[model samples]
Structure formats: structure tokens, C-alpha cells
Target: MYQGIRIAGFGGQGVISAGILLAQAGVEDKKNASWLPSYGPEMRGGTANCSVVISDGEVYTPIVSAPDTVIIMNEPSLPKFEPLLKKGGLMIINSSLINSRPTRTDITVVCVPCNKIAEELGMDRIANLVALGAFIKKTGAVTLTSVEHAMKKVYKRAKPEMLELNKKALQAGYDAVK
Candidate 1:
């Protein structure tokens, strides 16, 4: 497996949360993991990026200059992060917001209408989870069942009430991909 992953998007697109969940799952599976979130102009109607490292050995860098996978939720992030993904890496793009086609042919692209699915789920925020579910399926880096367990374990401390909704969101995301 590649040593690094990056999830980039807008502020409210849930990039940080998704990164957290992915990192937690990776660590739970006995892999060393690190999550780093960057916020600036990109966070406000611009680009936001989070680096998640999952490695069998100790992680060397928390910042990912080149990512093995990219999850894009907006057009701005598409261009910003497109070049950073390694050749032949997986890219899960939220086509609901990103209208442009990728220029890279080497990377495998999965364009899913995640915002539409989230809206159908009665919320427009779960698009990140949908993209993440597709990521899990394509990479086999983490399982949906394991992610569910991680979510409960992680969110239990801060927002115990979110347990059920997040579960539904993850399941909806997984089902949409299927």
C-alpha cells in the first residue's frame, strides 16, 4: 500500500472529519496513522486539504506532498490536489460540485454524485462519507464495518448523539456506491 493519503475540499465539505475517521480506522487496523488538517483561504470558499498517513512502519512525514489517493469535493480542490496524487493513484471526486474533467489518465477516477446522495439522505453534508465509502471499496484500505466501529469509538467522547446519524450516513454512502 502507498504510504500517504490526502483528502482535500472546502471547509464545510467534511474533509477534516473524513480524514479523522479514515485515520482512526487505519490505526485501529494496526497501521501507523497521522492526520493533519490545513486551513486558510482554501477553507472559506476555497481549497482545504487534510493529510492522512497510514503506514506499516512509522510515519515519516505528516505533510503529504504527493498523495496516493485524493478525495475532491469541489472544483478548486480538483486543480490544486490533482497534481499531487501519485501516478495510478485512486481519485474519488464529488461530481456534484466539480464540473471539470481530470487531465490525468494514469490515475483511476471515480466520479460519484455524492452531494445528490447526501441530499437524498435528508442532509447535504454526508457527501464526504459517500466519497469515503467509495474510497474504502476501491482501496480495501478499510472496511465499512470497521469504519462504523471506529466512528462510534471516536465520536462517543465529543458527540454521543451523532453515533446513529453518522452510521446512517456511512451506510447511505456505502449503499450509493453499490
Candidate 2:
């Protein structure tokens, strides 16, 4: 199986972190994975995105020009990445921040209230994790267990409570999808 994913959002929205976690999860699952990140000059509140490729065999490249799945975390990202999705791809939009909807009919769109769910979980920063959970549920690119295991490496300095909260956020996202 192979998945080319592009996750886009503002800088502080954990777009890069989410990509890292996904690639790490692939490693935890003993799969081939690569992550390439791009961002604007500003640190916070700037446009940020990452391309992640996960496959059971070798990964040909880290760049994903036409992604199988696109996770849009903000309003601007919707327009920026929507057209880059492969035909019949999946688009996971964070509806809490993005009010506009995609106009494309060739792809499937799943709108998740990522920020709303994260806030309900006690932190809005975990919205990316929530989105990740939805992606996992929809694509099965990697398992929840692998993602949790990957947190150890990606979020090396996280406290136990924070980890637990993250896990909860993921599960909530997963359950939210179906």
C-alpha cells in the first residue's frame, strides 16, 4: 500500500509536527516513509505544509505533487492545496477554522471540527492530532498503535499527561470520522 499525503496549515497549527509523526509512525510500522516540509518566513501564523509518503515498499521520493490525501487545517490552506490533490483523493478539512468548502467533485471531502474537538479535549494545539486520527481512520495508512509508539520519538520531551491527552485526541478524531 502507498499513500501520498499533503498536510497544510498555519505554522503553529502543528502541520510539520503532524507530518513528522506520520512518517515516524510509518517507521514504527516497519514501512518506508519520508517527510518534506515547507513554510513561509514567519514562524507562527505563517503558511506551512509538509509532504509525506508512506509505502510498504521503497519510497521513490519525498515530494508529493499530487497527493492521495490532503489535510487542510485553515481557510487559506483549502484553496492552496485543494487543486494539488489527485483525482478521487480524500480531503480532510478542519472545519473549525476553515469556513469555506472545496468546490471539487472528483474527490471525497470529510470536514472535521479539529479545533473544536481539541478544545473540548483541553487544548486546541492538538487539533493536528485530531486530523491525523481522521486520516488514519479513513486511509488506514498506518495503525493507531504505531502512531502512539511514534510519539515517543517525535514528541520526545512530552510529559505523560500530555501524551495521554494526545492519545485521547487521536482516538476522538478516529471516532469522529465514522
Best by TM-score: 2
TM-score for candidate 1, residues paired by index: 0.90
* Residue lDDT tens for model 2, 74-133: 998899999999999999999999999999999999999999999999999999999999
Quantify all predictions' global Cα lDDT against the true fold: 0.82, 0.95
For model 1, what is the error of residue 4's alpha carbon versus the real structure, in angstroms, after optimal superposition?
Answer: 1.6
Q: What is the C-alpha local distance difference test score of candidate 2? A: 0.95
lDDT of 1 at 138: 75
Question: Please, what are the lDDT tens digits per residue for candidate 1 over residues 59-139?
Answer: 888998888888888898888889998998888888899899789999999888989887877778778888878888778
List TM-score per model, in order. 0.90, 0.97
Question: lDDT score, residue 11, model 1?
Answer: 88
Which parts of model 1 have CA positions greater than 4 angstroms off? Answer: 157-161
